[model samples]
Target: MAEELRIRSNGDLASALEDYLAEWSGRSGIAVEIWALPGQAVSRRVAQAVYATVVEALANVERHSHARLVSVAVTTGKAGLRMTVSDDGAGFAVDEAAPNAARGLTAMRAHFAGVGGTLTVNSVPGGGTTVTGVVRAG
Candidate 1:
């Protein structure tokens, strides 16, 4: 199972995410969907970073967002390899940084930066949250 789950490249990320979400969605009843651009390729480092970002984002929704639905989309084009995780949950202000900041968001940001990528988060109170990470993978 461990070997099967290992992600050696970007090609493995979509299914890995789907598998990861399947476990929680099955038990928690939150609808999670993953869509990836077919044939898009990314470096191992970028793949790992993006995968980590997705994990953190989904975990956040599960733990705090109280979201009923979550969607993760992956694509590659002129803008590069990008992944967006959106959740229809009880959103919070993205500007009002918590005094005791949650490390999840910070870690997700760092993961993208470490791979020469950018992470953008957009959210408003009572609205949903969208987290997007893009890396130059071409």
Candidate 2:
């Protein structure tokens, strides 16, 4: 399953996410939008990390956030290729010390770190959430 989910390019990643959102759109009130910037090719390994990060973040939004809309973007810039997933929903405080903090987010952080990348999440009660994962090409 993991092998099948490997992303080959930004466009491919966007299509995969669109399919995922299509499957989940009916289950919740949220609508998903994806934007992929035209640029360089992404390595399979880095794409995989970005893919997983988006998948996990979307699942969280579907299950917990009663958000009306979610936006997913993949862009290549001077820093690197970055993926951002944002949702307008009731957010929760990000507590790294909390027991629940070590689950998905921790795993995502580790995944990005392995590829010389970083993951950042911003959320506050009633302020919505945005998760950004970045990876540089070697």
Candidate 3:
């Protein structure tokens, strides 16, 4: 499950991530909040991977979260890159009861796996969903 992607520079990655959020995340009528660390830092490969996962998670939120408020956040440190996309909609079980239900999370897992990273999805059926990822700095 290796995903091959061109590594983008920090500035380019930052811009790309923001643009992706603007076009894909916010346009869906779900509010988005971005919190990125200031300064030129971290690996672009990891940044892109994290950004892709965030966008995908937000996409799922937009498509199904039924939530008016969806939040996307990014944080980086020597520990690694952390991102969370959460919504206030009624959530579903992470179990595979239906096909494609977890497709986004699956792709997210693969995306991070391709970079020696990890993806975590938490959902409470009547509550909401939260997808988080952590990829080590390269």
Best by TM-score: 1
Taking every candidate in turn, the Cα RMSD to the unseen true structure, in Å, is 3.0, 2.9, 3.9
CA displacement after TM-score superposition, residue 62 of candidate 1 (Å): 0.2
lDDT of 1 by residue, 10-61 (tens): 4576566666778868977899876654246567677678777877888888
- Cα displacement (angstroms), candidate 3, residue 90, comes to 1.5
Q: Point out the worst 10-residue segment of candidate 1 by lDDT.
A: 1-10
TM-score of candidate 1 to 2 decimals? 0.84
Candidate 3, clashing residue pairs? none
Each candidate structure's TM-score, on Cα atoms with residue i matched to residue i, is 0.84, 0.81, 0.79
Model 1, stretches more than 4 Å misplaced? Answer: 1-5, 9-11, 96-100
Number of clashing pairs per prediction, in order: 0, 0, 0
The lDDT of each candidate is 0.77, 0.74, 0.70
Local accuracy of candidate 2 as per-residue lDDT tens digits, 29-136? 678776664256566677667667777788889888788899888887667888888999998888766635657778778778989998888898898999888888
Predicted structure 2: lDDT = 0.74
| Candidate 2 pairs with clashing backbones | none
Sort order, TM-score high to low = 1, 2, 3
